[model samples]
Target: MIHDQTLDQATESSKAKKAVLYRMVMDKHTCPWGLKSKYLLERLGYEVEDHWLTTREQVDAFKARHGVTTTPQTFIGGKRIGGHSDLRTHFGLRLQDPKATSYRPVLAVFATGAGLALAASWAAFDTPFTLRAAEWFVSMTMMLLAMLKLQDVEQFSTMFLGYDLLAKRFVPYAYAYPVLEWTAGALMTAHALPWLSIPIGLAIGGIGGLSVFYAVYIQKRELKCACVGGSGAVPLGFVSLTENLFMVAMALWMLARMI
Candidate 1:
């Protein structure tokens, strides 16, 4: 009926902070929202009385008693806080949208690329800051981007074909784009086969950049970028254009090395 959050019951901070959480922990399925509600209460310094509805009968009975339809209900100081979303509202926190477009994936890729570049610099040149770091940053970002695309090439290709000029005209190009990007990034990072990598980067980058500009600027079409993957929420705009431009710059920089 009641699950103690901790071994000792002495840790209730204040009457105002005290919360009661009712959740389900059935044999086959444990309610996630219940877990979240309990965690949120505990983290917010509430001494939560975690009540578990272990059986369907218990759940139904509890719901009927409370006049509520959902499990994982909370009550603060004898006042029902409703569900998890309702609890969040009580704390003035914004509820996240599952379908909202975000730049988080792009930010993560760039951050990873920067970190990898720094590590590569330290290992190779005995310093974190070096000209090679910039090169590696671009190179690593491209590889990471490509890797995400490669995970579901069909999904990425389908999304990409909507805006990518070459991919739209020649469907095969959509599938090939990720492979080409990965190959170029890998070769550039490893400092292997400049003859191949440089050209590959240039072609894909140039085409991609132009397509993004045309779709976002010229056509003014609002679309989710497939830059991360098909399921990603990155918007098609400057960030996508910048990704393409970075690849082009890296390719040119590598080409200039030979000259």
Candidate 2:
């Protein structure tokens, strides 16, 4: 992502050229998802200009000014590309096809384990026999989540790969969903609140929905994602919706089963 000042300079310089300007309102650390998105786009050969906006007020202002809501909000050719998740599907769908092997399973397993761990911790420590074991569990879960993400070789590849617009856009959104799973799981574990994970899962599912929504728009226009790093045939739009819907169902089931 280009610095705000640098973006301004480039925009001014490109006044005579047909250059597309993009912006992302995100925090650097907590929203590591945004960073991954930026990485994907850059990897896919797109020039992206990013800006940070932390508060809901800031997000609102961007939406009011640009007429949209969602984080990692993006604008291209002076048009809204929607938010981070939207862009992720946009780029992924543009790719060729899914490889025979995928890291998605690893991610799913990690998430399930984290969730079950939290449930176990809650059941065990619910009584007064434990000494702040909940806190310890929470911390450990958080660490595990971070470690799980870091363990993915694909993430490291996505991070260090050359900059592509599709890649830059997709990486953040793709990486974010999994991270959210872990974070929500960790938070639920920490509080020993299994019910909360349902909402959190639903929220993550919503992100997938957003991506699918945008993908349909892209497909209707017949534009392919340029962001796929080496992965081919990115599934756009409604595919994301299907995935999200499945996630929502799974989360609901998990909640019911656990309770």
Best by the lDDT measure: 1
For residues 1-259, could you state the per-residue lDDT of candidate 1 as single tens digits? Answer: 1124431232343335678888999999999999988876776667788888999999999999989999789998789989989987776556888799999999999999999999999999999999989999999999999999999999999899999999888999999999999999999999899999999999999999999999999999999999999989999999999999999999999988989
Q: How would you encode candidate 2's per-residue C-alpha lDDT over 15-87 as one tens digit per residue?
A: 5322133344445434555666566555445677667666667667867877665455656567666655666
lDDT of each: 0.89, 0.50
Q: Give lDDT: candidate 2, residue 208.
A: 48
What 10-residue stretch in candidate 2 is worst by lDDT? 223-232
Residue 7 lDDT (model 2): 44
Candidate that scores best on TM-score? 1
Q: Tell me how far candidate 2 lies from the true structure as C-alpha RMSD in angstroms.
A: 19.0
